[model samples]
Target: MHPHSPPWRKSPLRVWLSSGISSLFELLNAANELFSRPRNLSSPRTPR
Candidate 1:
């Protein structure tokens, strides 16, 4: 592999790493929404 190769075509490992990182970020965003929103809706005391 040439050092000057284009970034996307670097190697299978690099491609997989980039994709994994993106998916991890997406998962984190989803987790943040889930935790942040429910605090108001699902409180410790039940609404009657």
Candidate 2:
């Protein structure tokens, strides 16, 4: 085989990377939402 690779061979890796990145972004978004909205109990950011 030659040193170079074909497009079909790279598709699986590219797809996997894309999916992993999307999942990471989703997790970050969930964390951001939770931080943005505190629990029902008292919080330092919210005054009495």
Candidate 3:
């Protein structure tokens, strides 16, 4: 294997693990955003 070539690219297990981890991070981020703020639905927008 060439030193510059990515070893993970050739492995199915590594790819699945990496995608799972990435999806977990995305889920965490979405949960954080959902829990962090209260949306203001009553506020009127001012036209500029």
lDDT (C-alpha) at residue 40 in model 2: 43
Evaluated at residue 37, the lDDT of candidate 3 is 42
Give stretches of model 3 more than 4 Å off.
Answer: 1-9, 39-48
lDDT (Cα, tens digit) per residue for candidate 3, span 1-48: 557667777788898999999999999999887765434322344332
CA displacement after TM-score superposition, residue 2 of candidate 3 (Å): 11
- My TM-score estimates for the predictions, one after another, are 0.63, 0.54, 0.52
Q: Stretches of candidate 2 above 4 Å error? A: 1-11, 39-47
Best by lDDT: 1
Model 3, TM vs. native: 0.52
TM-score, structure 1 vs. true: 0.63
Worst 10 residues of 1 by lDDT: 39-48
Q: Scored by Cα lDDT, where does model 3 land?
A: 0.74
